[model samples]
Target: MKLEFHCWKCAKGTPGRRVTAPFNDSSVYRFECAQGHVYEIVLAQLRFEVLAETGMQALVDGYYRDAVASFAAALERVYQLYCEIVALSRDIDETVFKSTWKLVASQSERQLGMFIGLYMLENGDVPPQLPKKFVEFRNKVIHQGLFPAENDAVDFGQAVVNLVQPLLNSMMPRYTQEIEAFMIRHFENAEGAGRSDRNKHRVFFDFILQFDTEADDWDPAPADLSAELVARRSREIAD
Candidate 1:
């Protein structure tokens, strides 16, 4: 698969070329940009992290609707990721677990909450409630035609980012720590030059890496970005 990387030196997205490397008793793949900055590719959490950052950017750019949608998308990604984690932890078959998720997704009201409850039951981690709130807000905007305010969008986006950051850290410790260190170093350089845009990019780059980790064995359920949710919400609004 073609991967993208942010070159702190180039301050932009660069094409990453993949190469194999030996790790302990086995081999792993790594990516190198043209500038020779090599990084591990953690695809599992990368998708959700990218969605979360896109949502944050939309909020920063004053696109409230898109921000709400993106945050909702991020939250959904989190739910699916947690489900996959749960399944992996239990040694359950992917096909069975995915079929179960599909059935659960067909249900309305607190669907994500149910998955969160299952995860907490198994992992014993009391997840933050912000994701539940964000889901409600997303439903309101998409289904009730409610236009979320700027502050609400910003808060929700930040909350989702805060929640996912730690989860990614725990799931992929060494890789995340390395990425964090790299970003921190670059952040210092950007801060020294007083380039706010570069600093923002650094933050986004960190967010992107937050989702990339080594334990990416399972494929997450596909994200729901369709208009179907909005259409259903519209019908509810009319009634």
Candidate 2:
């Protein structure tokens, strides 16, 4: 099958050529661009990379990647990545932001699951839920050594049509919109928003002030906030 995808390096949308690589049923895709930036992807590695760079995941054949991380550890990693994505976007609908996000498109369950986790955490809306057969089919695509029946896989494709949106809504409340608005208001359109790299920290700082508990009910009247909290917030925004 053929699909259209963009290169991470050059931002050129190339028609992707997929070959069933070695490892037979493993289903690995080697995506290359004319400019020669190639991504050799399977299921798990793609998930880590997608979230690290784009706040999303790359799925292959209805498969997604996950690891059992302690809640605190996961929180630290995810939150840090979220802050970085926000800082890079600078309140703009930057190309990198759009190209990397996985809005649960077909054949990319990894992307969908990552979106689900975040959307759920943030109280976003989800579409319908896939039928149990489809869930099993998608799960088989992710975990090796789990061969689901071909009929189940086909059933999954059909049932997913209704459930995805509801599942998505169950997670985050207009998750994309709220974050996009944050980017536009402070980074893209804010006056005096300089383009210097150093000033980038200011954007994250502002983001933290907008969302973090440290800033909740902040008394701007008394010195605008305690000096210690200010220092802590500053350090967080920097790191």
Candidate 3:
């Protein structure tokens, strides 16, 4: 997945020099257009959100296998995010937490176990589990090189949405402070890692699954899988 940004100067009704940038963990991105204009952006969405969006896009474009893989990866990333917030609440130093997490980072099953243990410890209940059938479907697509039909991909995507969106909504009230702290640290780390002396402009992006926790009415829109696919297809055609 990649992000596209219009050059700040070129976006003013001029022939826009759209810059395409690689998608990575860093929120801070610096891109130079063909005209030698540079644009730096601060993407506000978390990695999981972007992964979900990438899955949606892949589904829309009929890359069913890729869609399933991305959605599965997004689900694992959600677990990592939950564990990170819990660590913040426990006052675990970021460096120590990261180094410790690295031990299990390469293995998704270990990450899932870590998240389940931590969630049960804090909430006294196990986190929701993905359907066994869906897990098998994902494995078939990801490991067995299966090319699923569009409906199958949509079903997988919706399953992920059903699990992730509500999980995030529930966490907001319970971990508002930790979530905010995570966001602050998220941006700080991104900026710090991409630090440069050159003058740069910063822009925040609104992503497909991003929620505004600061709003009084914090209801998130329902991600109707079929409708979302149709709308995305329409937008692509219109573009």
Best by TM-score: 3
**TM-score of each predicted structure versus truth:** 0.53, 0.24, 0.88
Instruction: For candidate 1, give the lDDT.
Output: 0.54
Which 10 successive residues of model 1 have the least lDDT summed? 20-29
lDDT of 2: 0.34
Please tell me which predicted candidate would have the highest lDDT against the true structure: 3
Candidate 3 local lDDT, residue 125: 89
lDDT (Cα, tens digit) per residue for candidate 3, span 49-76: 8898889878888888888988899899
Clashes of each: 1, 31, 0
Give the Cα lDDT of each candidate: 0.54, 0.34, 0.82
> Between 1 and 2, whose TM-score is larger?
1
Compared with the true structure, model 3 gives a TM-score of 0.88
> Residue-wise lDDT of candidate 1 within 1-239, one digit each (tens)?
12234545455434443233322211112445666874443223234565765665465456788877877776676777666666665667868877888877765345577766876886688765565677688778888988888778766666665665566555554334444443344345434543233313222233322443333632232222233234434664773
Clashes by residue pair, model 3: none
Candidate 1: TM-score? 0.53
Q: Could you report the Cα RMSD, in angstroms, for every candidate shown?
A: 15.2, 20.1, 2.3
